[model samples]
Structure formats: C-alpha cells, structure tokens
Target chain A: MAGSDGSNGSKEKSNDFANELPSYNAENMQSNMKVIYYSRTFMSIIGGVIAGILGFTGLMGFVFYFLVMAITSAGIAAKAGFSVHLYFDSWNLIILDGFLGGLMSFVLFWTFAYDIVHIF
Target chain B: MAEDLVLDTAIRDWVLIPLSVVMVLIGVLRHFVSKLMRTSSQLPDPKIVKEGQVIIRARNLRAAANFIPLKSFRARKVYYSNEENGLLFVPKGQAQNAQAQMFSDPNMAMDMMKKNLSMIIPQTLTFAWVNFFFSGFVAAKIPFPLTQRFRSMLQNGIDLSTVDVSYVSSRSWYFLNLFGLRGLFSLILGEENATDDTQRMMQMGGFGFDPSKSLSAEKDGLDILQHEWALPKFEQRAETVLRKLVS
Candidate 1:
C-alpha cells in the first residue's frame, strides 16, 4: 500500500536492501564451497603424480604438504563467504580428501615397489 | 672369461624384463584404485575477478588488433618489475585497492594479498610452463652426436660468446615481443616505465608513448604490432602493419 505522505522511497530502499542480502550471501556461499571442492580434487591429482615420480621420499614429505595446502585453501575459500556451516563443511571435505589422497599415494607407491622388486 | 660374462648378462636381462612388467601392472592397479576412491570438487569462483576483465585495450597489440573492440573498456592496473623490466596486469576493483594498502595493517593486508596473488598465479604459471616447454623443444631440435656433444660442452662450462647465437636468438625474439606487450600495458595504464624493454615496446606500439613521461589519459591513436599471427597466410600482412606501427 502506498503511503499518502510519500514515505515510499525509504520503505522501498529498506525492502531493496533486505532482498539484496540473501542473494549476495547465497552467491558467496555457493562460490566459496565450489572453489574449496575443486581445489581439493585438483590438488589430489597433482599430489598423486608427484608421489608417483618421487616414490617413498614424496610420501614422507610432499604428501603431508599437499594435505596442509588443501586444508588451508579450503579454509580460505570458506572464509570468503563468512558462513560458519560452509566453512566447516569445506574444512571437512578438504581434510578428508587430503587423507584419502595420501592413502592412495602410499598404496600406489608400495605396490609399485613390490612389483618392481618381485618381477625380476 | 667370455662364457662367464655372457651368463652374467643373460641373468640380468631375465631379471629386469620380468621386473618391468610387474611394476607396470602394479602401477595400473594403483591408478584404478585411486580413481575409484578419490573425491574431487569444482573450485569456487575466485572471489577475485578474472583476467578477461582486465583492460588490455590496444588493437593488434597481440595479433588481429582489428577484431578487438576499440570502444571496449576494462579496468586494470599494471605492475612493473624493476629487475626483469616486465609488466603484469591486475584486475581493477576493491581488490587492487586493498593490495595498495597492504603495509598499513599486516594481518588484514596479508589476507587480501594472498587472495589477489592467487588470482594471478594461474597466468604466471601458464607463462612459465609455455616458456619451459618452448625452451625444451628448441633444445631437442639440435642435431645429435656432434651437436649433442657441443650442447653438453656448452652446458658444462662455456662463455656466452662461444655459444651458438641461433639457440638464443629465437627465444630472445620471443622475449622482446612480449616485452613490447608489457610496454603497451604500461602505456594503457598511464604508468611511467623506467625499463629499456618498455621503452622499446612503446616505440613499437606507434604511441611513442614515452614511458619516461606520464601517459596521457587520451588515446594515443596508434595501431599495435603483434609479432606473431595465429591465423594462416596473414603473417606477412601482419608484419607489414607491425613495421608501420614501429616506424
């Protein structure tokens, strides 16, 4: 209902502000989670390739490094939105992905070593 | 003694062949397992802006300058490297503002710096990757035996004057070409260039946009010369235009 006194401008401004809030927040949250997810996945593959090249030495050093980087990157991504839940979720995903990546590398390297030693 | 040596060689070959097969099998199996279990997700939109948004507004600046819109405007800042005498573009926005103010507050500044740095990391990495790959290709094309020995000797310890210029010439051309581009960027952003490469680039861009002086906000009304043409049969035409721009 239009006010007779023409207070409509202020009311419209307030309503516009209210409407803008949710979308902006939503967009930021979505983008942050998206980046965190992608970073974890990409970093995992890079970690795998590195692990393959360097073997046990990579396992001891670089694997842990990848984990740390993934986790930190995830945190940075999550903080971009100021969303607590998104931040927590991103952190969880990063840490889990990192551990899995490390485990995978460990198994791969071990199997490779075994195969090489036994094949001869 | 000959018979003993033959037997030793036979044993080594037998062992190595089987080992190589087993290693391949193990590697493939591990790859499958990792593929099955690994969880990956898409990266969030870099809260930072993308490079396409940067205002690299010079026609034929790289190649096919005509295709690039003259009216097209994008916001960017040019970062000049004193040591390399190079320029890199940064997107314009609140991000650049935050970066310019980094030293005032260490904690806040560092956080902002990290985000801005991350955005450009991909570009620099791509550049490095291409440079190294190109260098490797050039290195591999040298004729073998004599050339290989020559290369190795040069690598081990050779004076710059003693090395073949052909090996260095092509790459240096590439360097100068890109340097001209950086110079164009400096001109566009109205930054003064204290580097020789930027000066040469400015001379080539037809702007005579002196890096020594403050770049004017008004368009210099000159064409740019791209050193390489991605399109077919256009190289000569492009070179002609480039020559005119520099001349």
Candidate 2:
C-alpha cells in the first residue's frame, strides 16, 4: 500500500503540465477564450458575406472562408503583441481553437448573401 | 452551370429577410428577458466554505512545507492528519452524497425549474411561429454543392426531389439559423448569453458540481505530498555566482 501511494505522488511530479509558468490563472484563461471566440465569430461572419458578394461557389467558397479565418488568426497573434506565451497556452490554441466551430455561421450568412445578390 | 432558375425577388423582401430579421430580434429579446428572470446566485453555507478552506490550507502547507523548518513542517502535518483530532479524517460512511444534498436544497431545484421554463417557453413559441408561417417554399440556395444525402436535411418541408439539393426550404432555413446564430448571439449579447440552447444542453448532460468531492480530493493530495528543502542548492548556486563575480 505504501509503495503504491509513493508511486502515485511520483506520477503527479512527473506530469510536466505547467508549461513555462509555474501556474496559470483559470479566470484569465477563460477570459482569453471569450475574447478569441468573439473575434473569430465576428470575422467569420464578415468572411462569409465577402465570399457571397464575390459570387464564389462550390469548394472555392469554402477555401475563401478558411483564407479569411487564417487572416483572423494572424490578427489575434498581432493583437496579443506576439508574446503569446503570456496570454495563451500555445500557438495552436490561438490558431486552431474554434476554427471549425465558426463554419456554421459562415455557411448560414454565405448562403443568405449568395441568394440575395447572385441568384435573385 | 448555365441552367439557373429565376426566383421572384419579392420573396427576398418578404420571406428571407423577414425570417432572418425576426430570428435576430427574438434572440435579442430572449436574451434580455432571461436576464431579467435570472436569480442572483446565493452564497454557499458557511460550514461548507470553512470545510473547503481547511482543504486549501492543507494544500498550501504541503506546497510550501520545504521552505519552513523541519519541526514546523512536522507540526503542521500532525495537526492535519493525526489519529485523534485530525481535520482530514472523514469518518466511515460519513462521506457526502451529492444527489441527496441537491435534493435537500429546495432552492437549487427551484432555480433549475425557472431556468428550464425560461429556455423552453420562448423556444417552443418561436419554433411554432416559424413552422406556422414559413412551412412551404424554398428560402435560399446554398453557395456550395451537396450530395443527394443532404436532400432530406436541406430540403425539408419541400417534396420536389427533382429540384437541386442546394435549395433550402423555409422551415429548414429556420432550423439552420436556429443553430447557426449562436455566434451572432455571442457577438450581440456578449459571452454566456442566456439565449444559447447548446449551452443549456451541455449543462444538462454534465453532472452537478459537488464541493465535498473536491474537498476530499484536495485532502488526499495534501496527504501524499512530500517535502525536500531546495534552499541548500540555492545557497550553492549563490556562492558560485559570487565567486565568479569576484574573479
């Protein structure tokens, strides 16, 4: 029992989860996530509108949507002053987090604008 | 690609724009209405707070034990885990059952009912309204091509299988906007807006938060923590730095 207990404590010590900082404030991380979420959503809506107005169809429309998303990711990094370690857990977090989640809004608005300007 | 069908532009003014506009307006209205209905979070019982604090105190002691003298560390550890008066001894069968606690608190159940009413009432009303008025006709065309599999989903309420799968019926468009407008709500009402159905669904699926479970987990963590002073290594490094500076 004592040996098992010792091993449990050792396992916790070996789990290198701190990532450069000794501790991360939970409140700050949540607030950062909210900020990124808002910006990403807003940008995707704009992207969809642009794609629709430009009369992009099929796979090309989807590609343009991602292109807009990529720009938004870069904008976030720039907004953070590029010392992303201080604000975010990792680069992938700011880049890829919620990237696909915004697709629903993108498609909804894209189709709306497409039908409005191009079709009718 | 040249075989494009002409749609009446009047439908855009009447059906499409009005549907989108009404949905957004209803969303904004729902957000404020629910905000008005929300009860302020009541404070947890003092006894629970103190018990939780005891666990935190033990954890802090464990983390900083090496900084204190060995005698002091031993004294604190004994005070926490001693066989007689130890704070960590949750007596056998005395462990808290979270479900029972939830039932015992009448206010929790009331709050949950109020939340459900706020979500369900508006949702049902809006869905009924959309279904009544916007059941027939194609609302808009999808900007991308879809397989035949998407026909049932995208072309709901319309029976014309000969029409392309890219065409969305009015009712299907309403469904699409219902889920898709989540981002728009966040943009409009800020984070944790009350109109989010997905957030409510997630809340229902996750188990209730139990304070006692966290308290016991913290106690176990504190119990297993081992202390080894690193001040001696810091002292060695300081000496080496001083020697280098002098040379």
Candidate 3:
C-alpha cells in the first residue's frame, strides 16, 4: 500500500509538470500550428478585402490598424504563451466582435437585405 | 432739388436688396421648420437594450467530476483574470471539499459549470453588446475634437462584464473556459497541439477559481469598481495561485 501511494504521488507530480509545458510535445505542435495558421490567414483575408476597397488610403489604414491590433494581441499571446484565439474563451469576445462586426453586418444588411426589405 | 434726387435713388436701391434678403430668409426658415417636424415625427429612438440575458446550452453536463460545496461564504470583489474567464467565487467557508474532490474527480464539477454557463453566457454577451453600442459607439462617434476623451469617459463610466453562476451542475475544470473569447480561442486552438502532458492534466482539473456568495446590485456595482481599483493585487493573487498549482 505504501509503495502504491508513492507511485501515485510520483505520477501526480509528472502530470503537474506536463500541464505547465509551453508547447505540446513535438507530436502536438502541428495541431497548434494549424490553429495559428488559420487565425492569421483569416485576419489577413479580412484585412486584404478592406484594403482593396480603401485604395492606397485604405491600404495605409489597414496596415496601421493591423499593426496595432497584432502587436497588442501578440503581446498577450506571448505573456500567456498561448495562441490569440484562446483570449476569446471568456465569451466577452462575442460581444466585442459582434459590436465590431455590426459594422459589417450593417453594411451587408443595407446592401443585400435592404432589397429584400424593399421587396417585402 | 439735387439732394432730394440722390436720397430717393439710394432708398430705392436699398429697398430691393432688403426684399430679396427677406425672401431668402423666409424660404430657409420654412425648410428648417419642415425638416425639424419630419425628424421629430419619423425617428423613434432605438430601443435601449439596457438589459438582456443569454442562454448558452452546454453540450455535456454529465461529464464533469468535481462537485464540492463550500461551507463558509465571503464575497470577494469581482476581478477578471484573462487566464480564468469568469468571476471567481471564493467562498470563505471551509475549503475542504473543493481541494480534494475538485482535484481528483474534476469531470463532475466541470459539468456544473458547463450547465450554468450555457445559461449565463448568452445573456451576458447580449447585454454587453447592447451596452457597448449605446454607450461606447455613441460616445466614440460624438462629433468633437475631444471624441477620444469622451470615448474613454464612457468606457470608464460603465462596467461591461458582470457574470454570476447561481448553480453549476458540478465544480471542476470545465468552468475554466469562462475567461473570454481570446482565452477560450487559445485553449481550443492550443489544446490540439498541446505537447505538455502536465499542462493537459492541469487543464483537466488543476486550475479553477473559488466560488463566492452572490452580491446585491449595489454590492455588485461596488465590486466592479473595486475590481478595477484592486486589479493589480488580484492579478498577483492569480499569479501566485497559478505558480503554486503548476509548479
């Protein structure tokens, strides 16, 4: 019984150490990489679309906004040693994003949904 | 005879100009009055969504393991930790059931949070958006050179996040997901590639917040203010807790 208790203690310690590691072992890095890749790609696409519409001025605005947002978000990611997406885990992001996204939603509603409203 | 002739011509010319000016003024006044009446009659103020609630259904409530109940109750000032998404409820009670049961059998405890979260999160998000637009967006768009100041003032004026979980099905690690979108996003994205077994285990049941007694509206408002004021101290507490648990 004593020996079993000792083994359990050791196993627990090992488990604790496992949780604190910054990166999943080499095997798991690919999965994490995919998340980061997708987030950055999505952000880039949005930024590019906005830039195309804004012209040179829009390009400048995109660069400026992206730099500020990226720097702030990346700093947070570094401090947490985690990806940016995890910050949204709190559920607060949905509100923040929705409010911010409301800009797009409004534009979409005006352009697409307005016709439907008019027709109806 | 010459003085009378000069005076007559001057008066006649001034009369025509004044007549034109009066006509223009009347036209402008009429337009403004009509516009004002239309504006007043047409636009109703958008309904002020001062209060709203969200119901987030948990996919799995039965999976959580921890269900420890606290004995004593002390309401801690509400503070947000990006690491821990939701407000911590630190009951000043006997901390017995929490430490062991929460650590060893976490799944049951997590289920409780998941169940309550499904209910709490949706409402909180909706109210937050309504508040954000009416409060933040309006303030930011105020046409003035000092708009940024107004935005900051408005931001400081209201507390955006207020979350309370009355009854969770359990009390385990799943509750850790409450931190924020960024935090949850990080967890989901990072969990897939997590190499550290220790971190994975910690995620399982090691990290959790102390539950607190519910506060009244006045108490809750004060708590938000106190949280902003005591933020540094609260963060230190979190860092210490994380260190002790992870190390």
Candidate 4:
C-alpha cells in the first residue's frame, strides 16, 4: 500500500535486473555458514594434528596446515562430483574463509599433539 | 635450555587418549543436542518481504545496468528515482519507524537468548566437569619452547613455580581439545554438523544477529543508490572487445 504505484516500478526493475545479471540467484547464492564453520574447524584441527605428527614447528607448522587444507579442499571438490569451479563458486565462504579461520585451532591441536607424541 | 621429562606410556593410555576420545564424544553429543534445540526462524511479514525484494531488485539493476540497452537502463533509473513512482520512495520517516520496531522486537530478543543459553550451558558444563575431575595434574608437555609470558596461559590450574611452561595440566588439555576437535566431529558427523565451538563462539560474539543490520543497510543503500546509467557506452565497449578479438 505504501508504494502502490511503485509496485509497477519494481516489476520493470526486476525484469531489467534479471536480464543483466542472469548468473546471480539469491537462492543458489545462499551458503550455509554454520556448516562451513564446522567443516573448516574440523579440517584445521586434523591438519594441525597431522603437522604435529610430522614434527613441524613454528612457521613451518602453518605452512603444513595450508598444505593439508588445500588437500582437504581438493577432496571436498572431488566429493562434489569434481565440479571444483561450481563448488568453489557457490561455497566460496568455506573455500576462502576456511583457510585463515582455522589457524588457531590448527596451532592448538598441532602443538598439543606434538607435545604428547614426541616430547612427553 | 629446558629439560625434557620422559612420561610413561601408561599416561598416554590412561590420560591422553581417553581425554581426546571424551572430547570428541562430547563434541558429537553437543552437535546433536544443539540440532535438536534449534528452532526454525519465523517468516517475516509479507509487506516486509515485498519491501526487501524491491530493494534487492534495485540493487540487482544497479549491478547489471551496464549490460542492458540504454533505453532499458534509463527506464529502470526513472522508475527507481521518481519521487512519486520509485520502488524505494517510502513515506518520510517510515523506514526509520520500521527499523525501530524491528530493533525492539521481542521475538528476536527471545531467539538471541535461546541461542546464548544453548551455547553457554554446554560450554559451562564441559568446563566444570573437566576442571572437577582433571585439575591439578600435569598431563602433557608442549614440544615447543615458550617465554615466561605464556606460563599463566599454558600452565593453568598448576601453581608450581618449578614446573616447565611446556607442561600442560589436564584442564588445559581439555581446553585445547575443545577448540581442536572440530575436524574429528566433521569426520564422524559430516560437514556443517552443529557441534562446532568456534561457530558458537562467533555467534556469541554477535555475528549471528545480522537481520536488523542488513535491513538498515538495505534502506541506506536504496537511499544512496546512484542510478547513473552505464549502458550508453556499451556499444563502444563491445566494438573495442570485438576489435581486440579480430586483432
């Protein structure tokens, strides 16, 4: 009721917008942030433990974490029918944010595992 | 140089492995519990949904305005910028009133409270249980060296001055496992499983309460959107691209 005349305006604008950006779909663009957060956390912890088992320390440990993350991302991509492009595009939140977001968890687990396995 | 203390294999079997397993089990349990606790969000009013769609359509037009023909771009610009007929031209102060109403909505407040309770209850219980059963004992040592600055953080609950900073108490180990067990949960529960502490922490930090922020942002964006058409130069750009291809 506020924009009775404007409703027609919206119809026109919506058509123009649709024609221009045919690739962008709001429903398809929606990524589950909760899932991405959990998966990234899991991957980073696993990566950290692996790095710890490999006896990596300091900056080398972080480098190892990224390596493991890349492998994990590749595995996820493969699991999604090898449509790496589509998966990365749709799930960019996880693919991009997951890299640095899990660093703290990686370091924590890596250092903990290193201590338990090698030192103590 | 710090000295290395050789811990027996019995400590690994009795303390370290059990602690790790317990942490993972708790994480899996928390995931299922939280999932059970989660309630679906209530749908917004149809009026609000229509308003949101109008703003979204305007934004989409702005982004893709360059691709359309000049006449089409101008039509959208005219429609959006007309004070009487513009999709976003609401009655003065109406947006502010709606925003205020949303900010004070009690249902939103209740949702936030419920989420906080879910995260806090599990976390507090886990912390208390770990501290009660596992306090006072040095369970494991960190392989790396640290300065005296980390003595308080790494050696929590242990009051001994002679104990190495590398030696972590059981409570600290539990804390470490709490933060680091996301991957094991993922392996067992699959991706996006609800048991992640990091996500809960992020939610607690107010990252989850974005509806109001986004609504306000949408209003601001529509208010400021410059409808300057980009399609007038499209033919020129297309010719240049074709020329480059031919060359």
Order of quality (TM-score): 2, 4, 1, 3
Off by over 4 Å in 3: A1-29, A32-36, A39-49, A52-120, B1-110, B114-119, B122-125, B128-247
Considering only chain B, report the TM-score of each candidate against the true chain B: 0.24, 0.75, 0.17, 0.72
Residue-level lDDT for A64 in candidate 2: 94
Q: How many backbone clashes does candidate 1 have?
A: 10
- Candidate 4 per-residue lDDT over residues B181-210, each given as its tens digit: 655666578655766544665664432333
Per-candidate Cα lDDT values, in order, are 0.34, 0.76, 0.30, 0.64
- Compared with the true structure, the alpha-carbon lDDT of candidate 1 equals 0.34
Per-residue accuracy of model 4 over A18-115 as CA lDDT, tens digit each: 44434443443343234445556776776777888988866687678778777666655455456433433455654576677687678777876786
Candidate 4 all-Cα RMSD: 9.6
What DockQ does candidate 1 have relative to the true complex? Answer: 0.01
Complex DockQ per candidate: 0.01, 0.54, 0.02, 0.28
Best lDDT among the predictions, by candidate number? 2
> lDDT per residue, candidate 3, B98-163, as tens digits?
456557656645644544454345436633633343232111111012223333332343333221
lDDT of 2 at B16: 90
Better of 1 and 2 by TM-score: 2
Error of 3 at B159 (Å): 31
- Compute the lDDT of residue B77 as modeled in candidate 3: 22
Local error of candidate 2 at B11, Å? 1.6
